[model samples]
Target: MVSAPTNLPSALAAALAERGHEVVVHTRRVDPDAPERQRLPSGVVVQQIVAGPVRPIVEQELAPWLGEFGRALAAAWRDDRPDVVHAFSWASGLAASAARQQLRESTLIRNGAAAAPLPVVLTFTAFGAEQHRRQGPVDPGLANRIRLEVALARSVAAVIAGSDDEVEELARMGVPRERVTLVPPGVDVSRFTPYGPSAERTDAPRLVAVGDLTPSSGFDTVIAALRGLPGVELVIAGTTSGDASEELERLRAGAEQLELADRVTFAHSAVRDPAARSALLRSADAVVCVPWHGPVGAGPVLEAMACGIPVVATAVGAVSDVVVDGVTGVQAPPRRPDQLATVIRGLLGDPVRCLGFGAAGADRARSRYEWARIAVDAERAYRALVPAALPAVDDELIHSNE
Candidate 1:
């Protein structure tokens, strides 16, 4: 992992580590004064790189960071190497690819013959181009990002998608179908389990909405839905704290303008921690995730389900792939407050059905979206790319010869 802040790589590294696989996270934080190395609770080694100034995630900063990361990775791999290099994003993929190339070249120089390219597995959580295409006119680095993804796809042995929606995007970007694997991003199911008794609010149906405060997040739509469902309060648990973000202010203004100030309470603090977030999810009657463009990791949705809370989400992006409409929970079309209100009302009206949905969602989350299962799938994808590691190939060759 090259970028340190994102939770996907950290969650994945921790998950893989728990599965008895060694995970080394290489990253650089914007705060140069931060610690150099730290060990995560799950036993993964996180080594921070000493790159340049604090910078935003743009092409200018990304290219230089990739170079810095590649050099460091190659140096480390040269001493005590790893079997496979798995990168979290396009920038990290480029760095990992460069390191692999350097290692291969060094091996060739030492020996008479060239060895096979070191297996590299890349996970692009979101394509910049794809996101731009969805929301109308293309973004600034649209061409550059697409070209980079296409180039990396050709070089990497395997590409693991965060969501099934990304699989088609990967294919469109020139990645072979065989090279792509759809592994939905996972949540810490063990911690987020719904083993405890329900914390239902007797006064009113409390609906929880967890995610960023951006306009696309659809908190406004959820608020609109709440107008029809009287006596229900919506708790928005993820807007940034301290000086409120523009989005947060906008949301507060919207709530006041809609005369929903009494019915809605913004948590103000972003619930990034799994335990806290899980607790927040558990405290709700139902969790609502109605993103206009769809969620990036489907984190909030999966976390809510894992906490045994029925979700009322818009059927968009990777959400449609994970949620079975009316089975696990309810699905409302984007920007439809009337339809969304009806769905939420139905779930709230039937306590038995809400309990059933919660139970079903929890079971599904445990079986399919658990971190352990996700880690194993990712591990297998990496192992499949490594020729020396795939001893089954040798066994097959021997059998064929016989």
Candidate 2:
């Protein structure tokens, strides 16, 4: 699997290994001292391949490295070919496409974001409005990147969508309907199950939100919703540094303005261990995911459901897919603070109802979103792409067979 330098692919690689599959994660760069290979209990292998340096400034550094990285992938594939190659981003898809031309036996799997080519101009106007509201100027590079991603997606054997909303987005971008597959992100249900009885919270309903505390995530909206709610405590676990620090401070000030300073707490500390993060999810009465911009998917929604916690989320991107209207959790319109507060208030008021939603969410997750099931589906897709034997035809053979 090829992905950018991030934690998403790392978790996926580990989960695939746990499902008894050999997983090799390829990123743009790697630490030389890192172990070359690690064997899991299921006998799966993980090989990390760092193609090159990934610099943020696209023109000065990333452009040249992209070409070099593509060539390096071709060279590596020529030495030893794998049965299937899964590419996570557009650049990875381009590399896998090049390698497939060299080694005719391998199947290419592609996954990433998709955007419409000519989104009625109003889309850009709306994006500009949102950008001006948060940041100063809109980045033109965002639109260009979306177009390139759409082009690269068309060249793969199968495209794995992280959400149903993303599938619709890809369809709008001219990808053939037959090639797209809806494979939403999966979670390790066992690891994130309900915590011990002693760890449960018995006070007022605890609402937990986790993500990079940025404007795009609409964390400010969540803060706004919690402002006047009595006896409700909000715990936000995520980073408040870099570009997001200013926004985080703004949110804190807002909470203070509403006289909710004591009720809200920001856990700037990282839950470095997965067990800790899982425990946090299990301890919460409900998980709140509110994003202003519609993302393809959010990991917290799945994690919360895995822990048997009802979710309250904005109806953006694939969030609706994970949080059924009243089954798993409640869905409110994006950026609507009042609606968000109302939903949370309703859920908190009815403990038995919220518990039922949490139970249904856990059942859904176990039945449909397990990593083991996803691995089997992925393996089946790979086999379908690779043929058992090559077809042979000659003048004499054709005549005799006929």
Residue ranges of candidate 2 with Cα displaced over 4 Å: 14-20, 30-32, 36-44, 54-61, 101-140, 195-202, 239-244, 390-402
Question: Cα-based RMSD of the predictions, in order?
Answer: 5.3, 9.2
Worst 10 residues of 2 by lDDT: 393-402
User: Candidate 2: lDDT over CA atoms?
Assistant: 0.62
As for candidate 1, its clashing pairs are none
Q: What lDDT does each candidate get?
A: 0.74, 0.62
What would the per-residue lDDT of candidate 2 be over residues 184-260, giving only the tens digit for each residue? 66778778775543134558778888766666887778888886467888888764323457776888998899888
Question: How far off is model 2, as Cα RMSD?
Answer: 9.2
TM-score for model 2? 0.80
lDDT of 1 by residue, 235-286 (tens): 9986432344777778888889989889898764537555666777888999
Report the error of model 1 at residue 108, Å.
3.5
* Worst 10 contiguous positions by lDDT, candidate 1: 393-402
